[model samples]
Target: MRTRTTTAALIVAGLLLTLTACGEDDTAAKPSAPPSLTDEQRSSARAAAGLPPEPSTTARYKFLEALNDIDRRIVDGKDDKAVSRGLNQCSSIKRASGDEDKQVELVKQTLSRFTIDTRLPDIATPETGGEILAAVHQNLCPDF
Candidate 1:
């Protein structure tokens, strides 16, 4: 009787192990790329997050062109960085809530932070910084 009970226990344990192994999804262990969102979905997401709609491809190209014109170093092999900084500036502008003075200050700070001269302790000059701000506003976040 004891031998029979031990066999039954072993069978139950084996069955449980087999069931647990089968229940696992092999695909779950592998990483998959995220689904691409449609333009409408992206717009809705931006709206829900309180961010302005994304700039058009043409607008982005123009923005990069303007940045390149202002100072090649700003976009030279750093296009992504420049674009990110502009977007951050736009967010700052929104937070400023139409305070022109605050917006200007924020732009200046952003320019200084991004375009600071490595050798010198100086930031971008007022003219260049103003151009950067203008490009960002006109292209990336005109509504803001």
Candidate 2:
């Protein structure tokens, strides 16, 4: 009986020691959260990447205005939606890495997905796709 008790105690102590060691190793190996960038640092990084300044109110307005000029129906009663779409386009553009064809195709796909007019055969043609690409570039990410 005494031998059994000693063996059980030894097993319990070994388990506790193993668990404590694992906890310490896990705490040391865990990564710390990355530091947040200040606005100036963010701007500098953007500039270094040849990206335009972050979109502002004026940029959003210009995006809407350009889209409205292209086809009023594109923004009809959906100004905020259109702006959000345009910003999404800007993100796609940045990812495209100067591939104009991919950029235009992305714009077309995005427009087709978002356009409310289901009756239209095609919401985006090459012409309008190019225009949309240009608009997004000019108004949202000029340097991209």
Candidate 3:
């Protein structure tokens, strides 16, 4: 019984040491900065707006790229996981501070390019989605 207890104690100590060692590696590693906007990102958002690049274009572009990745996964007929991932990406951007509404409007405008049949199911809501889109439209095409 003493031998068995010693072995168990060693095992527990080994686990604790292993966990401690693993944590130190992360401490040494630097946290990555957010990605900058690629040329494709700027073009896509601009395409949707039919206007010149805006001030928040880079940050906006990165947000859109994340959502686009989710969208590409969905278009490939991946599964509900892909669709759900897209929804979550949208939610993340909408939830972010500092011009979230503008980002949301960019998303709506991008989706508008797709045919009604090709679009995501109820992509924007009457409140969050519609309001943002309306503001974008009001600025871009106020003649309407």
Candidate 4:
């Protein structure tokens, strides 16, 4: 009886130590924030926008890159999957914009403007999928 109790206590102690060590490693491995853009990149982005240079321009460029990436994916034939991802990206931009109606209006206007590019494969043209992605980039990166 004494030996069994000691073994049980040792097992419990080992489990507790393992759990504590696992949690500490996870916390240490947490990802750091994204790095800021260099001065040259920021200046070029501002020049392209034809606006004054500012720290926020970096973020705007990053945001535009994200939107464009989705557009590329859509054009690459990912179709619905790209649309789903783009919508999520748009939601983040909309939240940042604090103008849901304006964003929606811009998206609608872009969709109306671009139509589907017929050069793409039929699988890449899902009703208004092409237009929707164009709309997303337009609304998200109006400056660009």
In terms of lDDT, model 1 sits at: 0.77
Full-model lDDT for every candidate: 0.77, 0.73, 0.46, 0.51
The TM-scores of all predictions, comma-separated, are 0.63, 0.54, 0.30, 0.28
Sliding window of 10 residues with minimal summed lDDT for model 2: 113-122
Misplaced by over 4 Å in model 4 are 22-28, 38-40, 43-144
Residue pair clashes in candidate 1: none
Which structure among the candidates has the greatest lDDT?
1
Stretches of model 3 off by over 4 angstroms after superposition: 23-25, 34-51, 55-112, 119-144
Cα lDDT of model 3 by residue, 49-92, tens digit: 44333425444444344334434422344433333333333433
Per residue, candidate 2 scores C-alpha lDDT tens digits across 41-115 of: 998986665556667888888888998888877788787777666666666777787687776577566556446
Please identify model 1 stretches exceeding 4 Å from their true place: 1-28, 31-38, 112-123
Sorting all predicted structures by TM-score, with the top scorer first, yields 1, 2, 3, 4
Error of 2 at 125 (Å): 1.5
Candidate 3 has what TM-score? 0.30
**Better TM-score candidate (3, 4):** 3
Model 1 C-alpha lDDT per residue in residues 25-52, reported as the tens digit of each score: 7997889999999989998987766577
Q: How much does candidate 2 score in TM-score?
A: 0.54
* lDDT of prediction 4: 0.51
- Give candidate 2 regions above 4 Å deviation: 1-54, 116-123
